[model samples]
Each structure stands twice: as structure tokens, then as C-alpha cells.
Target chain A: MVENRPVLNVITHLVLILGIVIVALPIWITFVASTHDAVRMTQAPIPMLPGGHFWENFTQTLLGSGLSGTETAPVWRMLLNSLAMALMIALGKIAISLISAFAIVYFKFPFRMMFFWLIFVTLMLPVEVRILPTFEVVADLGMLNSYWGLSIPLIASATATFMFRQVFLTIPDEMLESARIDGAGPLRFFWDILIPLSRTNIAALFVILFIYGWNQYLWPLLITTDTDMTTIVMSIKQMLEAAEQSPQWNIIMMTALLAMLPPVFVVVAMQKLFVQGLTETDK
Target chain B: MLKRVHFPRSVLPYLLVAPQILITLVFFIWPASQAVYQSFLIEDAFGLSTEFVWFENFELLVDDELYLQSFGRTIFFSAAVALLSMSAALVLAGFADRVVRGATTYRTLMIWPYAVAPVLAGALWVFMFNPTLGIFPFLLDMVGIDWNHYLNGTHAMMLVIFAAAWKQIAYNFLFYLAAMQSIPRSLIEAAAIDGAGPVRRFIDHIFPLISPTTFFLLVINAVYAFFDTFGIIHAVTQGGPANSTTILVYKVFNDGFVGLDLGGSAAQSVILMVLVIAMTVVQFRYIERKVEY
Candidate 1:
């Protein structure tokens, strides 16, 4: 913008427009396909515009048994399961990480650094790398096919702990000194001062972690065997498989839309926090 | 790293850390150790018995062509995804950085895709490229190009790569745009005064300045493609078309959970853990350097 060259500005706009289109085409196609009837969706060169069957498709996908042949849970049940899993993971990680970070930052205790390093090591052991043994552990604990199974094993987050630790370190030492002078115990200090201070950080992290928890695939896929326990994210795979025979593109795409809507809405609605959370946590 | 003025030392800290420590022990450390232990012991198919055969699984994997190819494929996939997504993001970010008006609008339009799950990304792309009914194939057919990921190995890889890259563009765009915007405006203005065009200034000045962000994103995207794209591959191809798209993570899951090759899968897990550790070390090193800068 130093020197506005007319041609360059035009080109920039064109390029950005093109980039947005290409980036958004898949979602657009999914939306258009969802709006159509099953008969029209199966035909070659499916309708590129909205169809009249949008309500029918949404109601059918949400309430009707998925794909007719597959023994899947109702869409509402799966969405509830996904919501439950996401909330548990986000809240659990924030709670434990805040306390652990508080302890590490505010206390001088034995094996404190050792404890920090233990949490740090979890960064290297993503679930994909240790699929078998983690599965065995979950199975042995009889956690399979439960909400706890879906959420808790994934709740211990090194990144969240580290981010909170960083946040705690930035708070001036005088706050704690004054709180101590006012006869506040450690828990009171944490609840009153630290929690309020890090509220935005917690909200930001919640935005990121909620999407993360909602989008979990491999863990939930492995642990959840019951139909009612299926997450909407995981059920898309089942619907895709079922589509080989049924080709219920309208219902399938509607389900896909529902599967992605919550996280996408969270991101768009709280984009500032989402971006802040992403950069901070990843760093 | 402790504060100068802190609470008195007591058993309270232990209680504070106990929940995280317990979860880490039960889920993270114990399973990781089991993976290492089981890697050395070959288990019978029926869970009857296991014989301690140290390094045999590793040795077999080293000699196994399929495992080796999967390792290579994983590297290639990671590189391609990083390149494709990064370049696209770079271009879009560069332009977005230029336009002052509607910058946030452009950003909002661009970044929401980051929220889409990998599995949903796969589902969306797979639907678009569905050979019989999809719009992409229909369009590609007009160009006289066949597109069937079901039977075509190359097409399957392309499909997953596209889906993975598509989902990742939003993340890379945000980072790249942030990095680019943080560059001092005076520098670009000075370059323009010196008769450097936008493209030349971009290549000569802006690009070099953001190299740290580039390096940081490269590692992040590499790690992401390695681990996070499991859902995409699972939903889209299932590592199929004769296992052409089977990366290391997929192969581990396939061999362990589906095929039930316990020792081999454990060995694979151990190797993957090593890879992750190495990547994490590199990323941390870069982050440390970024801090210094």
C-alpha cells in the first residue's frame, strides 16, 4: 500500500477472490448437495444451487435413522455425545492445567521441575504413536464405550499446562505477596486473583481445546463400540461407508454439515480468541 | 523458573500436581512404556504367550520393504502437504497483507476452514471427487481427465493431499499473515521508494524477513500432517487403492488395531515416538531461537 498501483490492486483482489473460492468450494459443494433430494444428488452433475428439499433433508438427517441400513445412533444422540466429550475435555484440561501451572509457578516444592518435565513429555506421545498400548490401557480400565473413555484419557494436555504456566509467570509477584499479607490461602489466591487474571486466556484456550475435543476421531473411533456413543465426527465415516450402497448424499452431506457446524461456529463467533489460543498454545 | 516471592513449600504442591501426574502416569507414561516393552517381545496371535526377542521387530521392520515404503511415503506426504498449503497460504496472505480495506473481512472468510475437522475435510473432498456423482469428476471429465480415487492410486493420494492441504490452509494463512503484517511498514515503503516492485520487494525483502515464521510453520505442518491427518486418510481412502496412501501412522493403526500384529505394531509405535520426539526437539529449538529474535 506504499504506492497504490491500480493494476496491482486489481490483481490482488482477483487473486484473493480466486483463493477464497478455491478454499471454499468444497464446503459450498457440500451445502448445495445437502439441499437437494436423494434422487437429484445421485444424478450426474448434481445441482450446484439450493434445492427445495433442505428442510426434509435436515429433519431426516437429524431425526430419522441414519442411512436406513446402518445401525447408527440418531444424529441428535451423536451430537450430544460430541458436545459432552468436547466440554469434558476442555473443562478438565483447563482445570488440571491451571492448578498444576499454579503449583509449578507459585510453589517451591520437591520434584517440581521433574513434574513439569513429566507433563512436557506428553507432547511427544500423541495418541497416534502409541495406539495399541493406549487402547489396551483404556480397555483394561473398562473405560470403553463411555463418556469418560471418550474424554479423560485425552485431557492431560502439556500445551495447556505450559501456556497457563507462562500466564502465571507473567503476573507480578506483588499480587501474591499482597494476597498473602491479606491472609489469603493458596487456594483463595488462585481462585480470586489468578483465575480472574487469566480469564481471557482460559476462554481462548477453551475455544481451541473445545474444537480439538469435538474433532477427535482416532481415539473415539477406537474406544466407542456402542451405537449411542458415536460422535457426529466419527459417524461421518460410517455414513460414507454406507453411501457406497445407499448413496444417500443429501442425508450424508447434511450430517457432515451438522458434524462441522459447532466447531466452525465456535471459531467464527470467537475468532479473535480462537486465533489467540492457537498461536499461544502452539508456541 | 519459579517466582522470586512464592508460597512456602509443602505437600500441597503434590496434591496440586497429582491429577495431571496421575493421568500422565496411567495414560501417557504407562502406555508408552508398554509400547517400548512390547516392541521387544513377540506375542502369539491368539494371546497365548510371548517370547522375548530383542530388536527382532525393529530388524524385521528395517528389512521390510512395505514398512520402508510407508516411511518414505509419510515423508513425501508431509512435504507435499507442507509445500502445497504453505505456498497457497503465502500467496493469499501476501495479498491480504497488501489490502488495507476489508483485510479482516478477508481474514474471516479465509480462516473458518481451520475449524473443520480433518474427517469432515476428508468427507467433503471425497464427496467432491466421488467418481460417479461428484462435481470435480464431472468437471474433470469435461477436460478429458479421468478421476476415480477408488481404483486409481495416484488419484487417491492426490485427493487426500488436497483435502489435508485444504483444511490446513486457514492455519498457515493466519500465521503467515500475522508474520507478514508484523514486518515494519517502513521497510516495505523504503523498498518501494527504491523502485522495487511489489513482487521484487516480496522476493527480496519480505520473504527473507519472515523466514523464521516459515521455518516454524514447516515444522508445525510436518508434525500435523504426520499425526492429525489420520482421520482424513481413514475417511477418504482407508489407506487403500492397494495401500498407496498408507502413511506411517495409518500403517501403525492398520497393523495394530485392524491386523493385530502386536509386536510389529509396538515397534512401529516406538519408532513413531522417536520421530515425534525428534520433531518436538527441533520445534522447541526453533521456538527458543524465535524468542531470542
Candidate 2:
């Protein structure tokens, strides 16, 4: 709104349009590729526009085995696996983090700071750094090839707990005193007062964690040997490898689109919460 | 840090924190200690035995040319990704801030890519540049530039950097835009009244105000390029052609999981842990400083 000369305004719009195009070109190409036939996709200078085979590609990718040569799970099965994993991680992390945050903030227990530091240490050791031993631990527990195997290890982090802890610290002490005067026990206070108060924070964290769980690649790649346990995000790698020989660009791109759709949908649908969660957690 | 009106000390607190503690001990603490321990013990190829060889793995890592090269390459990769994405996001965010209409629409279009997983980002980029069949290669041929990332090491690095940066632009843009919008409008308007143009105003006033956001994003993007781009590298080049694209994290996975060099891989993991710890300390320190601001 400050001194908007005509030339400056035009340049602003042009730059923004260019940025949008640069940002969107990859997805557009992926979509166009997904809509074409496999044979058409294999040819050079692939169609810039979407083809008539959108329904065919969607059904074939989602319903049938992804690539004919590949021994991968059905796309729907992988999507279901992804959904299960995302839901488990989001819900599990929220549940444990809420309770632990409540305990740390609202109870003067022994070793409270010790527990806080212990949880804080997880922030430094991302799973990538300790992949091997972590895999061994998970394998030893016989959690491999299962939903628990997919999610529980990843959930053992402090980001959500820290976020919830921060949120709890901001609540007025008067609320707790009032709740106690009303004879609300610890669990009752947490369930009735704390949970509703942090509703937006919970929703925001869930959005971030859901996308995170859905997009997990390396851990799932390591643990899920069985095709039935494969998630859609992990399946894209398999499909890409398959494409090297078969060159099923249409189906491969279709699978890629499907793998990303759920998380991307969540982000776009809950843009406000996603942004809040991202900014809050990182801080 | 406890509340003034906290619940009385009881076993209930233990019950409340038990699940998080249990998972943390089993998964995070135990495995991390195992990584540290395994780093000191050299395991034979067949898993038949492990001999305690304190400091040998670290020594080897220090002397190993490939490991040293990967360390350098990782730094280079992180720096390049950070610079490329941050600058692009800064420009886009700056312009987005100036636009009077459709800013939200542009923001929505710009930020959805943040949800795209690194692996999927890699897949999308790799498809567009797949040498023989890729659209980019076809276009590059018009310019007489060969575009085979499969064979060219530099091209492979460029491909990975681009893919990583492309995914990160959305994140940086959002942060930069938010920071830019938070600047007092009067400052820019005052500069405008003083006959400074938009670009001049940004450089003189707005940019300095958002340096904190810039610094925070530098660390965030560096950590991201360090850890999160594993998927992108795995999908795009698999550290390929001649190990040109192998960053430290990828090397750790390849050596441990595929080559089965348990001791050395564990040592690499330990080194990465130290780096992450250092970075986390720096980030937290900066955040503390930011709070003062």
C-alpha cells in the first residue's frame, strides 16, 4: 500500500506469477504425466497438457498392482497403510505428549527437570543419525512389518511435548486453582480443562504430525519388507525403480500423485493450522 | 517451571510421564547409546565377532578420504540449498508483500509444496530431468547442453540441490513473508516519503529488521538439508555415478545397511549426532537471542 507506482505494481504481479509458475511447474508436470498412457509417456517431449486417460490411470494405479513388472502392494492398500500410520503417530504423540506436558507443568514431582532434559535430548538425535541401532531395537522388539513398527519409534520425540508444554505454561494459574476448588482431580482437570483450552494447539500439531507421519520414508523403507506393510510414500521409490526398466511414467507419476495427495490435501485444507503448527513447533 | 497451584506430589505424575519416558528410553536413548558404543567396536564382516577398538573408527574416519570428502560435500550441499532456497523465497515473499491483491491466493499456491515429501519431490524432479526421456533434457538439447545427471557428477549434484531447494522454497517463503509482514508499515512508508524506492526501502530498512528471521531460517534450512534430503538423494541419484551426491547421512546408510560396515557406519552416525547437537545448541542460542529482540 505504500507508493504503488504502476510500473512497480506490474513488476510485483509479474514476479509473483513467475514464482507461482516455478513453484507449480513440477506438480503440473507430474499431473500431466499421470493423465497420459504409458506408451505416450515413454515418448520424448511428453504431452504438456493432460490426456484423456485420467480415469484409466487413476483406477489402474489405485486398484491394480502399481506396475505390471513390480511386486508392489496395491495402491489402495499402501494408502490404507499410510493412513493407519499417520493416524497412529498423530494421535499417539498427542496423547502421550499432552499427559507428559501436563505432568511436568502441573505437578511438582521428583526428577521433573531430569525428565524434561531427557525429553529435550531427543530433539538432537533425529532418527537418521541413529538409524542402525534404532532398527535393531525395533527388530528386537518384533515390531517390524507392523503399524507399531512404523509409528511408535518416530513418535518418541520431544517436539510435540515441548509445544504442549509451552502451551500449558501460558495458561493462568487461576484456572487450575478454580478447577481444584471445584474438586476436579488431576485427570479430571486435564480432561475437562487442559484439553479444551489447547484445542487449537492440538489441531495444529496434529496437522503437522499427520503430514510428517504420512511422509516418512527411510524408517518405513528399512522395516516394511512385506509388500502388504508398504506405505504409499515408500511405494513411490519402488515404482520409480520399476520404471527404470518398464518406463511406466504414467502409472509411476500417478502413484507419486497419490502418495502426496493426502498430506498435501491436509496442508491446503488446514492451511491456517498447518502454518501455526509449523511456526510454533520450530520455535 | 512448575505451576504455583500444581497437583500434590504423588505417583500419578509417574503414571502420566511413563509412556513418553518408556518410549524415549527404549528407542531414543538406548539406540543412541548403542550407536556410540558400536562406533568404538569393530565388527567383522560376517557378524561373527566384534573387537573393542577404541578410537580406531574415529581415526579411520578422520583419515578416510571418502568420508572427509562426503563431509565437505555435505557442507557444500547444505550451504547451496540454504542459499538458493532462501534467496528465492526472499524475493517471492518480498514481491508477495508488495502486491495489493491476490496475495493470499499466491501464498496458497506457493506453500502447498511444503507438504510434498522429499522423496516425492525427488521423484517429480527426477522425472522432469530423466536424461533420455525427461522434458528438461529435451529442452536442454535445444541449447546444445548435455543433461545426463546419470553420468555427470556435477549434474547429479545440481539435480539434487535443485530438488531439495524446490521443496524448501515454500517453507522459507512462508517464514520470510510472515517476517516481512510483521515489520511496522510506518517504517516503509517513512522511507517512501523520504524518496526511497521499494527496493531501496527493503535493503535499507526491511531487510535489516528481518535478519533474525533470516538467521533462524539459515539454521532450519541447514538442518533440513542435512537430514530431510535423504529421500531426495535416495530417489534422484542414490549417491550415484561416482559418489558425487553422497552426503554424510546417505553415506552412513549406504555403508551400514548395504555395505555392512557396522563400525565405520556407527562412527559416521556418532559424528552426525555431534553435528546435530552443535547445530541444535546454536539454534537454541539464537532463539534465546531472538526472544530478547
Candidate 3:
């Protein structure tokens, strides 16, 4: 607002428009490809505009045995698997992190710092680094091909716990004293006071974690050997691999769209919480 | 730091922290230790024999030409991705900050790609550039350029870099835009009053002021380019076209899972762990310094 030259303003708009186009071009193409039939998609210089087969591809990808002859599970089944895993990861991370953060901040217990550093160390050990051994551990524990395999190993989040700790630290001491004066026990106080107070933090973290859990590729790829256990996100690779034989770009792109829709919807619908969670957790 | 008015010492704290600690131990700690242990031991392909060969695996990795090439390639890839995405984000953020209206709308349009998984990002880009049937290849045909990432190493690397950088733009843009908006308006206005143009004002005042954010983002983007782009490479190239796009993380996964080189892969994992730990420490230190700012 300080100095708005007309030329500069026009350039600014142009540049931003260009940026948006570059960013959205792939999704647009994916959409366009999804709406076309397999015959149209295999043609060169595929249609820039969407085709009329949107519902056909959507139903086939969602309900039918996706990419017939491929060993991958149906799209709806994979979506359900993804939903179950995502919910378990997001909720499980929030639940464990809230209690652990509660214990670390609100109770003077033995080995508290030890436990804190232990959790902190997990930040360095991303699942990508220890992929094989972690797979072995999950397999050894008989957790493979199950929702627990998909979620539990990934749910021990250092960022969420740290975020909750930061939120609890900013809370005034008077709240705890008042709760104590009201004769509320620790569990009661946590359930009534801390939980309610950190509500927005939890929601914000949930927004971020839901996307994270849903988008996970490597972990689920390793453990989910059973086709029924395949998540939609991981199933894209299967479809892509299967495309070597079928070249079913319509169903493949549709599966890709379905895999990404929920997480993308969460981000767009909960943009505020998404931004808050992202910035706060990284900090 | 504990609260000033914490509850009395009791077993409740243990009860509360048990779940996190147990998961951390069983999954994180145990598996990580196993990786470290397996790194030092040589295991045959058939799992019929495991011989303790301390330092041999690390020695082999140090001497291995392919490992060295992968390491150098990873550095190149991360640096390229970080530079491309960060500069793009900085430009868009710089312009977006100038927007007096509909900034949120601009932001919304810019940031939804952050939700797209890396693999899906790869899929989308791969489709757009599918050599035989892609839009880009078709367009390039008129200009006498044959684009086949499947056959060309350089094309494959470029395709992966583009996809990875594309996915990262939303993240860097968000952070850069936040950093820019947080700068005091008066500084820019004062510079404007001093006869500096917008570009000049940004170069002199705004850019230097956001250096800390820039530094923080460099580390963030480096870590991201290192780890988060695995799915992208896996889905797009699978580190193919003669290993042109095989970053370190991909190499680890391929060697371990696909090739079944247990010892070598475990050693690679250990090296990656060290890299992540080093990066995490640097990041935390930057955060501490950022707090002082």
C-alpha cells in the first residue's frame, strides 16, 4: 500500500498468476486425465479440458476391482484402510502426546528429563533411516498387514508432544492452583482443564497429522504385504507399476485423485489450523 | 522445564508417560539400535550366516564408487532442490507480500500442493512428462526435442528435481511469506520515502531482515529434500535411468528392501541417521538463536 505503481502492480498480479498456474498445472492435468477414457488418455497431447467419463472412472476406481487384473485391492477398500490408518495415527499421536506432555510438564516425576530426551531422540530416527530393522521389528511383533502396523510405529510423534508442552507452558500457573483448590485430582484436572485448554492446539495438530498419516508411503509400503491392507496413497505406485501392462491412465489418475482428495480437502477446509499447526510444530 | 505448580511426586507420571516411552523403545530405539548393530555385521543374502565384521561395512561404503557417487548425487540433488524451491518461494512471497488485497486467496491457491503426497506429486509430474504420451513431450516435439526420462539419465534427474521442487514450493512459500509479513511495515515505508524502489527496498531492507528465516528454511528444506522426497523418487524414477536420481534415502531402501544387501543397507541407514542427527542439532541451535532474535 505504500507505493503502488501501476506497472509494478500489473507485474505483481501477472507473476502471482503465473506462479499459481505452475503450481496447479499438474493437478489440472491429473483431473483432465481422470475424466478421459483409457483410449483418449493413451493419445499424444492429451486433452487439456476434462472429458465426459468422470463418473465412469470415479466409479471404477472407487467401487470396481481397480485396474482389473492388478493384484491391488479395490479403491474403496484401500480408502477405508487409509482412513483407518490416518485416524489411528492422528488420534493416537494426539492422545499419547497429550498425556506424555501432561506428565512431563505438570508432574514432578523421576526420570522425567530422561524420558524427555528419549522422546526427543526419536526426532532423529525417522522411519526412512531405519527402514529394514523397523520392518523386522514390526514383522516380529506380528503387527504387519494390520492397522496397528500402519499406524503405531509412526504415531510416536515428538513434534506433537513438544507442541502440547509449549502450549501448556504458556498456560498461567493460576489455572492449576485454582483447579487444585477446587480439589480436582490430577486426572480430573487434566481431563477438565488441560484438555479443554489445549483444544485448539490439539485440533491444529490433528489437521497436520491427519495429512501426514494419510500421505505416508515408505512405512506402509514395507509392512502392508497383503493387497487388502494397501492404502490408497501407496496403491498409486502399484497402479503406476501396473500401468506398464494396462496403461490405464484414467483409473490410475482417478486413484491418485482419490488418494489425495481427503488430505487436500482437510488442508483447504482447515487452512488456518493447517498453517498454525505447521508453523508451531516446526518452531 | 516443569511447571511451578506441578502435582506431587507419584506413579501417575509413569502411568501417563508409559505409552509413549514404550512405543519409542520398542519401535524407535530398538530398531535404530538394531540398524546400528547390523551395520557392523556382514550378513549373507540368504540370511544363513551373519558374521561380525566391525567397521568393514563402513569401510566398504567409503571405498565403494557407487556409494560415493550416490552421496555426491544426493548433495547435488538436495542443493538443487533447495535452491530452486527456495528462490521460487521467495519470489512469489515477495510479490504476495506486495498484494494489498486477496493475499489470503493468493495464499490459499499457492499452498494446497503441500497436502499432496510426494509420490502423488511424482505421479502427476510423471504423467505430464510421460515421454511417449505426455503433454510436454508433445510440445517439445515441434522444437525437435525428444524427451524420454525412461531412457535419458539427465532427463530423469531433471524430471525428479522438478517434481520434488514443485512439491516443496508451497511449504517454502508459506514460511517465506510469513517471515516477510512479520517484518515491520515502517522499515519498508521508510526505505520507500528515501527514494528506494520496491526491488531496492526489498534487496536492502527486507532480504537482510529475513536472513534468519532464510537460514532456518535452508535447513528445513535440506532435511525435506533429503527425507521427504523418497516417495517422489520411488514413484517416478525408482532411482533409474542408470541411477541418475538415486538419492541416499532411495539407495538405502533399494539396497535393503529390493537388493537385500542387509549389511551394506544397514550401514547406509546408520550414515543417514548420523546425518539426520547432525541436521536436527543444527536446526535446534538455529531455533534457539531465532528465539533470541
Candidate 4:
């Protein structure tokens, strides 16, 4: 196959190289800028070589952002808070979507389509669209600045629900029927049959939800008024904003890079599931 | 009340849907109602409080220069990105559907940007557009056209739209490509044998087959553009260069969070919610059914 079509293969490689360049250029620049010193960074064309200012820039940023603890921005604590918030969201959304999907697909109950459509509607009314009112609701609920504020409202992801429902619809009907014939209830059948059969899907949804939760900024930023309660992305955002006033390219870039590590790690680790998940088409 | 009790089977679905229902109610429905209610009240656009002066917030928003600019820019940015990205994705996905080898690798790299957070994508672009040492400026300088997003409104919004679209076009490509691959190859083979050239074959056969995914993405991307693109706008332009890049969500952000004009923000948010609901309902009722298999 490789030897059969040299011209076609070359065109493919050429286009792909173009794509790779387009994708990598900005990211590559970020890495380069993160290594340069503050003074040399302002110079013409800037320095591409890794400089000695990484530690100085990172430390100053850490201390300057008051992230060095002491009644100020607790970086580690906030990271933990962000992690906990993201994880809970991922977990809550996954558990709900899986069970809801299993129920909707397998059960012969009434209004299944209604329930399905209700879930689908959220796909349209995404959290951001209703963010203002949602914030007011959170405030009214007495959940503002609490962990629940950071988690609940945005965590019930309709996209995940719809995706899981789509996948659940794909589980062979005979598989469900046969399992039911063996006297398995919905829970038993779901736990014993559907879930095991949907390992690729579960892995896929896990990564998808994890990414979604991790990348959440607006809701978290809106609800958490205190600087001490910031997510990593919001923290980087504040740094980037401040860097605008007092230019610290290295620190901003480094913080941005660090902010990206967890999701990039998620992407790299679950690249397989992601490919399969995105590439899987339903009839 | 103990007259007739439902079985566990009947009650289970409600049980499953309760949390989502409650959360969606509290977050989406109730707040939306508040926003709608609030939008009717009169208030200063920059202030935090409001009185029951009827049908005025929307009227005020209609007349406000910055608000109008944000609205127009939102529509333009959303429509342009959706059209450009969807078409590009379709063409690329069509070509990608053919190659049996390295398809996984292609898919992997293609969807990579979708995973990059919008905030990060925006920040990355901001870095790339840095006036002094940014790649874009450096490239433009190489071409003899000095470019700076910070100094130009058009450049600012253009970069903002492109940043939002870049993260998504590949995602649309992946989904559409998967859909195209599902089209029986025999159909295309038959089209080929029927005296159709590659272009003709794709135009007549493969194109219609993937219309459904294209249509699905059209609405999804429209909703995404209309509602979810604040991170890019905020992080990259911050509605700067004289408010050229300020979209609706960014406006909502600024109004509520930054300016503390909570009622006004809620009003804008409500208007946005109504627009989304109407669009989505139209999609589900009409456009969705147009999708082929």
C-alpha cells in the first residue's frame, strides 16, 4: 500500500506537515518564550535559546501572585480545589450520564424519548448562555463561594448525556434481551453487561468529561469571588491579565504552560480512547 | 394518597433524571426566568441595581452603541466561523475518509485542538500576536504589512474568531469524516463506475451523505459561537481595540462580573437564553429531521 501510490502519499504528507506546523508554531513559541528573561524578551526577534530566568520568573510570579501562601493566593490549595472541583464534576457527570443512558436505552418505559429530548435540550442551552441567571440562582441558593458553587450547576453536562445515550443505543439489543432473560434487572444488566461491553466508551467519556471539567473557567470564576479559591486556568488568566500591565512574558508563558499540563496529560494518556470516541459513527 | 403506588420500574427513570432535572431547573430554567423578568426592568447599563420600569432594558440594549456592536460582531463572527469551519471540515473529512492507512493517526492529530482549553487557545494566540516578538507580527513584518491586534479592531476580532474556529474546525472534521467513512464504499464505487469523476462523484454522492453531520454541526457550532466563545474573546482581546471583539457572552461577563451590573447582565443573559432556546427548538423540530441516516 505504501509503495503503490507515491504521489498521493506525498500530497498527504505535505498537507499534514503544513497542519503540524500551523498547530505547533504557537505552542512552540510558548515554550521558547517561557525560557527567555524579562529584559531580553523585549529585544528584537527575542531569544530562542533557553535562558536562566525561568526560576527567577517562576519564583517571582509565585511570590508576586501571593501564591507563596500567607493569607494570600494559595497556589497548591487552589490547585487542589480546582482538581477536586473538576474531579467531582467529572465523576458526577459521568455517573449520571452512564446510568441515565443505560436506563433510557434499555428500559421499555414511557417518556424515554421525552427524557432523552430533555437531556438533548441542554446541548442547546449550554452553561455559558445562561451564565448570568445561573450565577444569580447559585447566589440565591446560598451556594456561592462554596464547593457546590464550583461544581453543581455546570457539572450536569447534556453533551455527555447525549453522547452516552448515543453509545448506549449501540449496545446490541440481543445482548440486553439475553441478559434480561437471565433475570437481570436494569442495574444488574447495566453493571454486568452494558458497562463491560462499553469499556471504550466509558474511557472515552471519562477523558471527555475530565477535559470539559478541567477547562471550565467562567462558572468557577463567576462563583468564586475570593482570589484564594481560583482554578489553575483562572489563575493563569489573572497572571496573563497582569502581565499585560506589567509585561512578564516568561512568567505568563510558564504559568500558561503549567496550567495546560493536566489536560495535555489527559489528552496524551487517553489519545486512544479519544480517537475511537470521536471517530465512532452511529447509524 | 396510598391508593395506587407505582412500581420500581416506573419510578426509576425519574430517579435517574432527578438530579439533572433539578440542576437544569435551578441553573437553566429558573435563572432564565429571572433574566427574562429582569430584562423588562429599567436600569443603568453600568450599574448594579434596577427598578420595575417595564420593557426598557431590552430597549436600552437595542440603542446602546457598544451593545449593538457586540451583537453585530457576535452574529458576524459566529456565522463566518461556522460556515468556514464546517465547509473546510467537510472537504477535509471527505478526502480523509478515503485513505485506509494512517487514518487513526490522522484522526488523532486532527482532533487534538478540540481538547485544548479555549482559554489556553486564546492565551496562545495572544502570545502569538505579541507586538514585539509574536509569531504573527513577525510573520507580517516579514511580508511588509505591520499587524497588531492590540492596535486594530478588525485585526483583533479577526484573530478572536480564528482562534475560536481553529480549536473547532478539526473537531468538526473528525465527526464529519467518521460520518463520511460510514457511507458504504460500494456506493461511491458504483458512482465512480457510472462515469463520475472524483469531484463529480463526491459532489453528487458523498456530499449529500454527509449533509446531516454538516447540518448537525451547523447548529452546534452556531450555538457554540453564540454562547460559548467568551473565553477566547476575553483572554485574547478583552473587548479591546475600542470594543471590536466584544461578543455577547463577553458582554455578559463584563456586565455581571466586571462591572457588577448584575441585573443588566442577567437581562443580556436572558435574551441570549431565549435566542438559544428558539434556535435549538427550531433545529430539533425542523433542521434535525433533514439529516440523512
CAPRI-wise, candidate 2 is high
Greater lDDT among 1 and 2 belongs to 1
Per-residue lDDT over B71-165 for candidate 4, one digit per residue giving the tens place of the 0 to 100 score: 88889999988987787677667656656778777766666677677888889888777777776788789889788888989889878877888
Off by over 4 Å in 1: B291-293
Runs with alpha carbons beyond 4 Å of true place in candidate 3: B291-293
DockQ for every model, please: 0.91, 0.88, 0.91, 0.38
TM-scores (chain A) of the candidates: 0.99, 0.98, 0.98, 0.84
Task: Give the Å error, residue A77, model 4.
Answer: 4.3
A1-283 per-residue lDDT for model 2 (tens digits): 9974999889889999999999999999999999999889988888889999999999998998779988888999999999999999999999999999999999998899999999999999998999999999999999999999999998866889889999999999999999999999999999999999999999999999999999999999999999999999998888888878889999999999998899999989999999999999998
Give candidate 4's whole-model lDDT.
0.73
- For candidate 2, give the DockQ: 0.88
Of 1 and 2, the candidate ahead on DockQ is: 1
Q: What lDDT tens digits, residue by residue, belong to model 3 across residues A69-145?
A: 78888899999999999999999999999999999999987799999999999999999999999999999999999
Among all windows of ten consecutive residues in candidate 2 chain A, which has the lowest summed lDDT? A153-162
Runs of candidate 2 exceeding 4 Å displacement: B291-293
TM-score of each model's B chain? 0.98, 0.98, 0.98, 0.88
- Tens digit of per-residue lDDT, candidate 1, span A29-147: 89998899899988999888989998999999898886889999999999999999999999999999999999999999889999999999999999999998999899999999999
